[model samples]
Target: MLLLDLLLMLLIAYGFGFLYYGLYRNLSARVHGRFGPSLAQSFSDSIKLFVKEESTTFGWMFYLGPVIMASGAVLNVLFIPFLNQGESLQGLSSYGNLIVVLYLMVLGPLGNALGVGSSGNPFGVMGVTRGLTRLLALELPFYLAAIGVMIDAGSADFGIIMQAQSTQSNMFAHPLLFAAAFISFLGFMGKSPFDVVGAPQEVYSGPATEFSGKFLALLMSQSAMFSFAKLLLMVNLFWGGADHLGELVAKTFVLFVAATFIGSVYARFSTVQSVEFLIRIPTLLGIVGLALL
Candidate 1:
């Protein structure tokens, strides 16, 4: 049953991710006054990539990296809630909390960085450097928002956090943190401004440029997982966990739209500029939120 529940959550998150891939394309197209591909475009792309020829630069480690990344993403999905009190596979809520989730969230990216580094591509290495650079700044607001939630809830377990918000959402209590977090989330989503790592104009898809075939397919799927996990994290942090599946989807869609708009409205920032922006603004807000708490 636990295994089945875990699989179900993975499937659900993947479905959302698949939908998001199409949603992004369609929305981007609409903004440009051009009709876009159907919402299944992402699924189509994944299918095409799956049957393509596999290429490898590094040996055993390259093969291992995607697998590890996907595994970590799957673990992350199981740890978060979709339908409140609905189902949790690992029963890890007892030991798990914001701190654990935060650590787990980085695991997939770390694995991807390792894989990309092993491939011996200068561009991929540059992407990893940009990713880490941006991460250093972007993490502060998220950390501040998370700590505020922890303090308000008096516990780090997400379920308890949700319960605490049943009476009053954290967004009200920590508006500064929310603003900081929401802004930082833009960076986290790798949209404009903070998309330095994968900026096609500059880095040529960055770290994943060298990936092909099955490995690429796995990476794509993991991207969807990462997207879903991020939405879940945001919802849990600000609004608390959704009370129903419909509510969950609604919240996720709202976040997706917000991320897309931010991506569209802002021009891409250079790595240094992005780091500077995160540091001076969101970082300071986070510090204030923590101090206020």
Candidate 2:
């Protein structure tokens, strides 16, 4: 029964994740005054990559990279409760807390970095370096906000946090913290102004430069699932977890649309610029939010 629930969760993550990705492209194209591909284009692309004739690898480590990344993503989905108060949708969330989920989030990227480094691709290494550098600053405000949430609720448990917000969602009770987190969340979604890690013109696809065929397909699949996990995290933390699947879709879609529109308007930031901006602005908001708490 537990395994069946887990499978259902993965299916939801993959389905909605790709749906949002395709919507992101379509929305961005509209902003640029051009028609975009259909909403299923992302799924089609993933299938095409999977069926490609060949893929390159740099030995066992490289081969394991995408697998490890996918594992981390899957673990994240499995550990996070889909509903605020329900046995049906909750997976292994009872066995973990926010801190555990936070640590799991970084596992995939770190594993991918190792594989990219071993692939002997200078561009991939550079991309990984930029990603790591950006992450240091990216995580600060988010961590601070998360800490404030946990402290306020007096527990690291998601259910506790959600219960504390029964009268008022965190987005309202703690606007400053939400502001700080939302800004950082924009970066987490790889929006413009914080998307230097994979700037095609600059890094030739960044950490993904050497990946092809099935490896690339696996990365895409993991990315879709990871993206949903991040969205679910924010919804649970701030918007309040949903009681039903429809409510969940509505909240996450609103958040996703906000990130997409913001990303479309801004230009890409240099690595140094992004780090400096994050350190100064969102970090300051987070500190102030914590102090207010």
Candidate 3:
């Protein structure tokens, strides 16, 4: 039964991850005053990539990159509970806490970086450097906000935190912290302003330059799953965990839409600008919020 639950969790993560990404592209298109591809387009693209063979191979390291990335995403999905309830719906939520989920979120990107580094492509190397540079700045504010929440609950456990929100969700209890985390979340999602990592222009000279065919496909699928895991983390932390599957969808969709809309309107920042903005704004807010806590 536990194994079945775990498999269901992975299926949901992968399925909804692709669906949400397709929604993002659609939302981005509408905001830009243009029509986008169908909602299934993301899945279709993944299938196409799966069938296409890579023309060049950079050895075992490159092959292991996407697998490592996907593994992190899977762990994240398994760690976070889908609904705030008994041990049944919770996957491995009993065994882990918010801290573990946060760390796993970082693992995927770092894993991808290792693979990119092994490629010997200067562009991929540069992209990884820029991404890791942003990542370092990314964690401070988020970690600060997370610490505040854990302190408030007097425990690092997700169950305890969610239960505390039975009266008032963290969004209201700690708006500043949520705001700080939300900003970091946007950057984490590779959204605009902070999306300096692999924007189309950046990718032309960035990480995706080296990967092709199945490698690229694996990256895309893992990215989608990782993104949904981030959404799940935010929902669990800020909104309080949902009561049912329907409630879960609505909460995550609203958060997803808010981020997508914000991403669409904002211009992509340069690497330096993104790093500075994250440090100055979100980090400062997190500091103030933590101080209050």
Candidate 4:
């Protein structure tokens, strides 16, 4: 039963992730005054990439990186329940809590850093280093916000947190924490302004620059799934867990659209600028929220 539920969650996340990403591209294009590809374009590209033969120019580290990433993403999805008051959609959530989920969240990226370093491409190494540096700024405020949520609920369990918000969602009760978390969430989505990991002129591509064929395809596949898991986590934390599948889609879609529009309006920030802004605004908000709590 648990296996079946997990399988369903994985399929849903993979499908929805690509769909949302496609929407992001279309919306961003519209914001920039141009027509974009169809909503299925991203999914089609992932399929096409998977069908193609893989390149073997790199070592085992290069090959296993995406696997580890996918594993982390899978763990994340399984440990977060989709509905607040249901046994049907529960995965492995009963066995874990907020802190466990948080640790699993960063596991993939840190695991990938090993492979990115093994690639031995100067630009890739540089990109990974910058990405890790930016991660510190991204994580601090987000962690503080998560801590506030855990403290407010008086328990680290997602069920406890969701039940506590039965009367009022955290978004309204702790607006400052939500504000801090929302900003960090945008960075986590790798949206504009904060998305400097792929800065071509500044650092030349990124961690996946050297990968091609199967490896690159796998990375994209995992990225799509991973993105949805992040959305699920956010929705559960701030909006309160959904009552049904329709509600889940609505909440995540609203959040995705908001991030897409916001990302499109802003110019890309430099690495230094991105780090500094996260430190200044979101971190400050997180600290203040915690103090009030």
Candidate 5:
């Protein structure tokens, strides 16, 4: 059962990732009024990446970093509830909690930082520095918002939070938290307005520039996995995980669409702008939510 559950979580994450990749292509094509690649383009790209020769200037740690990051993402997904009354798998929820999940979310980036730093690429190092710097401001609002949820629900356990939301969705009770989290979520998703860390214009894909071949494949997979994990976290926190897969998908899609729209409409912010905004506005709102709760 454990193995099966793990497989199911990974499969679902990968499937969603593929869908998002397709959405990216189709969305871009529509934006420009041009034809786009097939929906399976991401899958083909992954296949090609996997088969490509491994290239590394760093060391085995660089190779291992992405693997660890991807593993963390898969584990994170397995711990989040996708449907109420259903756990990722029996016994898996024993260790799952808001605190642990938040740490798990950071695990991948930490690994990437170490690996990228070891590479000695100026851009990779710069990107890593920028990412960690931005994380400081982004984290405060998210933490405050999470604390508001804990106060409203009376526990840090994600399952309990969901049960509490089942009575009344947290979104309604703590709209301020929802706003703060949504604001942080924009940064978490690495969308345009908060995407300074990996800006191609300045950093040339940032930490990922030095990676190619199998290493690139692992990084890409982990990125998608992280994206899905973030979405599931939002679903659990705001949408109650729904009662069925279709509902879950629909709600998740709506959230993603909101994110996409926000990402598209806003111009990219400088790292300083991102940090300043996160600290000043969302932080205040999160504190307000905590007070209200």
Candidate 6:
């Protein structure tokens, strides 16, 4: 029964994740005054990539990178409860807390970094370096906001946090924390002004430069899944978990649209610029939020 529930969650994440990725592309194209591809384009692209004939790898580590990444994304989806109060959608949340989920979030990226490094591509190495540098600043504000929530609820459990927000969601109760987290979340989503890690013109696709064919396909698939996991995380933490699947889709779509529009308007930041801005602004907001808490 538990295994079946886990599979269902994976299916949901995979399906919605690609759907949103397609939406993101379509929306971005519309912003640029061009007709966009179909909403299923992302799914089609993944399938096409999977069927391609050629893929390159640097031994076992390269092969394992996407697998590890996908696993981390799956684990994240499992650990985070889909509904605030329900046995049906809880998955493995009972076995973990926010801290565990937080740690698991980084596991995939780190594994991917190792795989990228092993590829012997200078561009990939440079991209990985930029990513790690950006990550240091990116994590600060979100961590602070998360810490504040945990402290306020007096527990690290997601259900406990959700319960505390029954009367008022954290978005209202802790606006400063939400602001801090939302800004950092924009970076996590690889939106404008924080998307230096994979700037094609500058880094030649960054950490993904050497990946091709099935490896690239796996990366895309995992990325789609990971995107949903991040969206779910924010929804659970701030808006309060959803009561039903429809509500979940509505809340996450709103969040996704906001990120997409913001990303479209701004230019990409340099690695140093991204780090400096994150450290100065969102980090300050987070600190103030924690103090208020």
Each candidate structure's count of clashing pairs:
0, 0, 0, 0, 0, 0
lDDT by residue (tens digit), candidate 5, 52-158: 97745678787776777887887788777667776543225566788888878788778888888888899998998899888888889998988888877798887
Clashing pairs in 3: none
Candidate 1, which ten residues in sequence have the lowest lDDT sum?
86-95
Give, for candidate 6, the lowest lDDT window spanning 10 residues: 54-63
Which candidate has the top score in lDDT? 2
Q: For model 2, how does the per-residue alpha-carbon lDDT over 69-102 read when each residue is reduced to its tens digit?
A: 9999999998889999878779899999999999
Summarize candidate 1's per-residue lDDT along 53-89 as a digit string, tens digits: 7655688787777888898888777777665565553
Residue 284 of model 3 has an lDDT of 95
Q: Cα deviation of 78 in candidate 4 (Å)?
A: 1.0
TM-score of each: 0.95, 0.98, 0.97, 0.97, 0.95, 0.98
lDDT of 3 by residue, 1-293 (tens): 99999998888889999999999999889988999999999999999999997688888998788889989989999999989986566899989998888888888878888888888888788888889999989998999999999999899998899998999999999999999999999999988878877766756647777888888888899889888889999999999989988899999999999999898788888889888999999999999999888
Q: Pick the winner on lDDT between candidates 3 and 6.
A: 6
In angstroms, give how far residue 57 of model 1 lies from its true place. Answer: 4.0
Q: List the candidate numbers ranked by lDDT, top first.
A: 2, 6, 3, 4, 1, 5
Q: Which ten residues in a row have the lowest lDDT in candidate 3?
A: 199-208
| Alpha carbon deviation, residue 261, candidate 4 (Å) | 0.9
TM-score of 5: 0.95
Off by over 4 Å in 6: none
lDDT by residue (tens digit), candidate 4, 88-128: 77888899988999999888888778888888888888778
- The positional error of residue 112 in candidate 2, measured at the CA in angstroms, is 0.7
Model 5 stretches astray by more than 4 angstroms: 87-91
Q: Residue 94: error of model 5 in Å? A: 2.9
Instruction: Please report, in order, the local distance difference test score of every candidate based on alpha carbons.
Output: 0.83, 0.92, 0.89, 0.88, 0.82, 0.91
